[model samples]
Target chain A: MDYVLELQDVSKTYGHGRTAVKANDRVNLQIQPGEIVLIMGPSGSGKTTLLSMAGLLLSTSSGIICVLGEQIDHASASHRAHMRLKTLGFVFQSYNLMESLTAIENVELVMNMAGVRGSRAKERARELLAMLGLGERLDHKPADLSGGEKQRVAIARALANDPPLILADEPTGNLDSKTGQEVMELLCCGLGRDQGRSIVIVTHDHRLRSIADRVLWLEDGQLSETDGNYLPEMT
Target chain B: MFKLAWRNLLHERARLIISVGGVALAVMLILLMAGIFAGSEEHAVAYIKRQPADLWLMQDGVENLHMSSSLLPPQVVEDVRGIAGVYQAVGLLYSTGAVDLGETEVYSYIFAVEKGAPFGGPWDLMEGAGSPGIDEVILDSDLAARYGLGLGDTVDLLGKQLRIAGLSEGTFGIATSITFVNKQTLAGLMGVPPDAASYVLIRPESDADRVQVADRLKEAIPEANLMTREAFVASDQEMIRQMGADVIRAMNSVAYVVGLLVIALTVYTATVERAREYGVLKAIGADTALLMRVVAAQAFISSGFGFLVGIPLAYGIGALITTLLPEMLIVIEPDNLLGQVPVLLAITAAASLLPLGRIIRLDPMTVFKG
Candidate 1:
């Protein structure tokens, strides 16, 4: 199978000697194109660390991380940034949008960073926001939007660059249950099934398991696949 | 990037106004100080510059017309006129005297000009005759309006009654009000011999080289100090600058420091406030240079608006000074205003440094957290 992301025995350690903390230990994972993978774990169980390593945001102490067929473990910072821009998208829990910019502008900012400019960038931004059911709220700033609308804007921003792999870290954590389900439905059904983009979500919500093609459980710096019966209260 | 910078500034309107207002006030202060200095220098040399003489001859020890007194033998004027390049030579007598205006005694500098000569007389005759007869005086219009004196009005100078024969424009220096009279009258009033004068004014022939004529005249009258009109004007301005350059420099230093601090604090606070947004940008693939451009754009925009507000404010202040202090001259030239452009740009550039460091070191990982 064609893999969008593959982590081969990746381990990350913080600090030195006796004080060293192992965040990720020999983690091996793979997500195929058009697949949705959910990673669940208790707090401080290296769920975010695994996502960070897979996204090329954090370096691994040992082993290799490949995204979109490129081994990024030994890449320079600038080269990693280029790979991130060209091959990956990110959705955070807080809906990180520039407060000064409107919804469409926030979406367009990512495109701008990718060297797209003028009316073409604006058109793409409008198309993305409208596709996410935010057509009427295009001109509204983040402060003026509800939690659901803000998450939608963040999703629109992540999809601005059209990267193959979407790394979402608790994207629906801050929303109400209804809004969180709606956001997950938009991601799994709209982006995965329709656009054929691979998704890796590090979430604590048990309800999200129904939409995942496979569920991965993380415990004490180790990752393992499990059936939905092993769910825990990770809050 | 530019739009982001502009929107970020506008997001905090109150802070934006304060930052721009601070820079505007600084610019206004610096311009005002420079304008006042230039005006004073121009005023000090007004009378000398208006004269038609190419060369001025004084006693060998005298360098300026304000504080020093020079007495030349009357034969020197005739001897200078005998030179090949000399067109006309006239003797002038300068003395300080007080004019009694009934309730006030106004100090005046008496300029005694030879009758019918072009060298040492008022050229801008606003009203009445250019040449004042014996026991007559030509007053600057500014001086006349101040004292309510007009043509045909008589005033007491040196205990002698003299009639106001003419009024000239722009003859009032910063510290001196000049009054022109016949040479014989002033010589008689001071009890000096009619054959003696304070300085000799010489006009070179239209076809003659002024430097060569001045050199030849310098050789002829070795006992006198000879200078061209430009040299004398420069010397007078230099003397006046020496009196106030220190004060102007101090004021300029204060203004620049204040400007720098205002810009630094505002831009730094703004950058720190937006640190999270900058981190998100970095996480999303923005380079440090791109981030710095945004901060620099903020500084430049603030300075541009400040300059827009400052230039008009400086002109308004100059107008107010002119209205409140009629005797004071505040000249705002275009060059003086344009000269501040580079200074403002430098200040804005320097101000961006404090914020640029914060942006460069900001951790992009912070954007992942709530």
Candidate 2:
């Protein structure tokens, strides 16, 4: 089966020469359609770096990076942006919604950027926000929304264009335990369905493991598979 | 996308006001400078414009009335009238000098209009008659009001104390004041023949092509210069414009710079403040072009609002200036106001460039850092 995302011998190095630090050293990973992959690691373990590379937000020093079965390691900046908009979505740790825009507008903005406009974009935004249980808070700005609500809005935005892959980095870092569980369940769906959407979440929270189809362990710039219940020592 | 840019601008009321107000001040400065130049242009040509003559005749080689010297022989007026297209012609004695009103002396263009002759006199009068007696002067009523003088008040001209018997309207300007005296009175003081005019005002016959009439008069009086009214007014206006061209250009430059800086600084600051949000947008897959377009749209809206608000403010100040200082005319011409649109647009684009670069180089990866 064609994987939704693939990484082969991808490496990212900061600086050069003697001072160079390898963030992701020859990392390889693959994710299939409708798969939910959770990447858990200690501080500075290169989880964000791996996620950044997969999301096309950062360039890899060497190796192949593919999204939706298309090689994109050498894509132009403009082309990279187009791929991100059309084939991938991102949920940042900070909830990263445009604070100036209302919840519905925040969702509509991504659609508008993707050639969706006017009433069509508006209707899609309303449906997404309503699906995220933010139907009554469409006009609320980011500042006015609660932590869970903001994350929900960010999720709605991530799902706005219904891209095949979603890359989230610590999406529940700022949320309470119960709300974070509820939000992650809504993400993988409490209804137990992904609708053919793949999600790659990087987080330190172990509670998210229940909602993920596969929980992957990332340590020292390398990714490894693990049994669902295992937790590494904090060191 | 445009809505996002607008929302960002409207997010903070205080910042919005400062941004819009800064642009408004710049627009006001640009418009006021242009209005003054246009206003003074009219004032400079007021003398010729107010006359009803279709053509002007003067001494050979003399071009305009202001800063010019012309003395046509007395027979030149008759010679110009003898041409077929010339319906009527009147001789005028003109001089540029100071008119002493007791403790105040006003620089003035003193014209001697022949009694009861058509044209070459005050076109509008506030009081008294268009024709002045030997010992009487027709002066601007606004000038008279400014100095606590009225009709029958005494003003000293050419060392002779004369009464202000006629009050003309629209004769006072920043350049000089125009006052009319009897042709015989000024001729004696000027030591010239009463018939030897500084310039001759000519009227073309009904149904006559003014260009042909001017050509015929020029041919008939080869020793004197003959010009159609349009050319004569343009010539004088050009001379006056050249006089202040350097100063006006410098002022316009300063105003434009101020406007440019105002827009640039505010837009730059706003963009910088919102850089994080911009990075977020980029991270979420917004293209560089769409983001840059947002920045540009915000800048245009800011400057557009300023343009709309500044015009009315300029007009109000112009009216106030006219009421307070009657000698200075501040004319707000539509052409002058509309001309700044392109320059303001250029300024808006230039101002957005700094922010555009910031957006262009912004790393979308930064948004991923917890």
Best by TM-score: 2
Q: Please give, as one word, the docking class of candidate 1.
A: medium
Residue pairs clashing, model 1:
none
- State each candidate's chain A TM-score: 0.97, 0.97
Candidate 2 residue runs with Cα over 4 Å from true position: A190-193, B81-85, B102-104, B156-161, B205-216
Tell me the spans in candidate 1 whose CA falls farther than 4 Å from its real position: A15-20, A61-63, B59-71, B82-88, B94-195, B204-226, B238-246
What tens digits encode model 2's per-residue C-alpha lDDT throughout B1-370? 7788789888976877887887888788877777777777887688788787888998899999989889988888788778897889999999977889877899888999788888788888889988998888998999888789998899999888999989998889875788899999899889999888999989888889988887888677788888878999989888878898899889988988887888888888888888888888888788888888988888898999889888998898888888898877888888888898999999999998878788888888778766
Query: Interface RMSD of every candidate?
Result: 1.2, 1.0
DockQ of 1: 0.56
Candidate 2 chain B: 10-residue stretch with minimal lDDT? B31-40
